[model samples]
Target: MADELDWQLCRSFLAVLDEGSLSGAARALGLTQPTIGRHIEALEQALATPLFVRSPQGLVPTEAALEIRPHAEAMRAAAASLRRAISGAEGGARGTVRLTASEVVGAEVLPPMLARLRERHPGISLELVLSNRTQDLLKRESDIAIRMIRPTQSALLSRKVGVTTLGLHAHRDYLARHGTPRSLDELDGHVLIGFDKESPSIQTLRAMGFQMGREAFALRTDSDLAQLALIRAGAGIGVCQVGVARREETLVHVLPEDFVYSLDLWVVMHENLQTSERMRLVYDHLATELKAYALTSRR
Candidate 1:
């Protein structure tokens, strides 16, 4: 066993953990399956512990693997940040920048803005990770994160973009077919699209005086995009950001005064990236563009 841990080994280990199979990790890392297997073996030998065990489904991670995963992820993030920083110093904004955001924002909000960024800085390559769960900026999971809520990590440099204003909305056809619910109490009689499980958004809505549950929804899904799709298909009434809803003429506001869910949007990155021009450039660009987009939600 040695004190030094190889980064490549850690990468393979992480890939296997994420993909749940050597073949999947091999494809993800652009390496041969045997290469990935060797890396995992070397890593396990270095630590003198079995990281994973064979299972009927696939390679199931051992307790040791789960414990070491975060440390490996942190190292990966640091190495990526170092490469970006060095590239920024030697040249200009020419490197990969990984950005994470909620699914709806990633699908609906970021594409055009990222396109504009690519136009402005052709050397900058972008990687977007879309997930509703918060990505840990401190761990360097992403170079920058566009978050719906204010980030509380002390090591993160965050900027409040603006409020993403949400309101109850439905397709015109659905409203025409079912008629509009005149009040909150009347919602019981109407079809609704909402989360099938409790999430931060659902809890927030509950706190805001919406007394609906999973059973209340005619169609249920955790994905914001899926919910919006259902709304567009005239499936039922659901909540959507005004900024997003405005793009579809078919989506009409159901209760202008009744349901308003505003979440503070933020763009955050690790403080270590302060010196990286590419990171800074993307951060500023996101702040400016996202603020403008959020302002539209106010309308």
Candidate 2:
């Protein structure tokens, strides 16, 4: 153990925690397996505790390791943010910007905009993290985020992009085969695609008379992308972003009058990064592009 904790040891610790083995961590960090093993052993000695217990499945994290993970992850995010900040100051718009958004938005919405951005400023690079789970800007988990909800955190700078309208949609082929439901109640007779587990948004919908129980869905998944894919695949009638559905000519809007839900979309970044020129460029670009994307469903 040394006077000050080494960050490399912590980085290796976090990698092993995520990947579940020394070899896996080594591959992720581009280090050799023996180096990763030594880092882990040093980290454990520094902390004065055993971090992992081996099993037939692989190295399983002990309770101490699990408790240390969030702090280690926070350190990783801070290190990345610090690097980006320094690079931004030195190179103008030539630095990496990490952005987070939901799966559907990351896949379907942002690629074209990002391609254009790259064409305009080839020096600027992007790292996109796609998940339904919200990344904490305060912790610097992501430099910027596209959020469905309002940013209530004190140190966040946010721009309301627009609203994303959600509605029932079905492939033309599926509708031709099964017939379109005239009302919300008629949905019971058709194959429905929806969330396997109730989320806060679904709970809100249910409170507002939307029927989205797990049992009601014939094709069940929590991934918004999966639900949208099922609708595109003619799997069944499912809830999808109206803007996205319009992109596919085969997808037909179903029960527009009966069901209309809007999720408020925002582009948010940490207040600390508001002064960074490169950060501002990406932040405003996202707000502009997403606002346009949100308007497509108005048709």
Candidate 3:
């Protein structure tokens, strides 16, 4: 096996790659530009190859950088994991756990779980990045990830938290005003609210004979919270997960048992973090909390 490279240098390389320039990376790391330069130089010397090429576009990574990116990321995650393990061994649950998830998971799923985590581990801090785009766990962009779709990356570990049930929902007042359509064919005249872009749930709804197209959205927002708020305000009718829609009494199931879809939720972490006490605690707690809503009955 190749001799282990300098971890500090690898970390600097990752920082440079993430920030897109040495100066930016230096600012992020709170180090001088010269120090950052030395780190990169040492890393290249140790590996005996050029990892990046400097250009007008900033530091462009070479093929070697691309090849070793995953390993370098694993090293950084492992280091964070080690810090958590050491802290726990010292009898303190401390360190930052970075988590990434979609807007729905961030707004509807993780808040309660985070509350419980705060109560249980007072010293642990959480950094949550909520976006529709998938954050790379293997690249150390996040310590843990909550995703609707199961991840297939070989270097990451994943567990199915539970499945979420989705159904057509509308405000009680909206249904009273517009009247509920009994058949999918009757949906033509009824205004529908849905995700703007292609999503699994949207595709599922389309497959189920719902007429969802560019003209379907009477109101649309990227944030699930915003969408739910609009639905609660009786802006339009749309599909929502049972767990999210059930929380609001004003939002009632439209199709009820006639139309429903299910999607699996997965809690994923880099394999390097499996032994990390902080990451483990957060991951396990989220999984347990999510499992409670797995097979919820529509109200």
What's the TM-score of each model vs. the native? 0.90, 0.95, 0.69
Residue range 1-299, candidate 3, lDDT tens digits: 24757888888999999998999999999998899999999888888899899899899999999999989888887787566456556444677788888787787767888998999999898888888777777667788888877788999889997788777888989889999889776666677776667766556556657565755676766566677777888888877888888778888887676676777888999897777677788888888887886755233
lDDT of each: 0.89, 0.89, 0.80
Alpha-carbon deviation at 5 in model 3, angstroms: 18
Query: Tens digit of lDDT per residue, candidate 1, span 169-243?
Result: 999999999999888878888988999888876776677776878898989999899999999999999989899
Clashing pairs in 1: none
How many clashing pairs does model 1 include?
0
Candidate 1 global lDDT: 0.89
> TM-score of model 2 relative to the true fold?
0.95
Worst 10 residues of 2 by lDDT: 203-212
Under the 3 Å rule for N, CA and C atoms, how many clashes does model 2 have? 0
Off by over 4 Å in 1: none
The true-versus-predicted C-alpha distance at residue 47 of model 1, in Å, is 1.9
* Separate clash counts for every candidate: 0, 0, 0
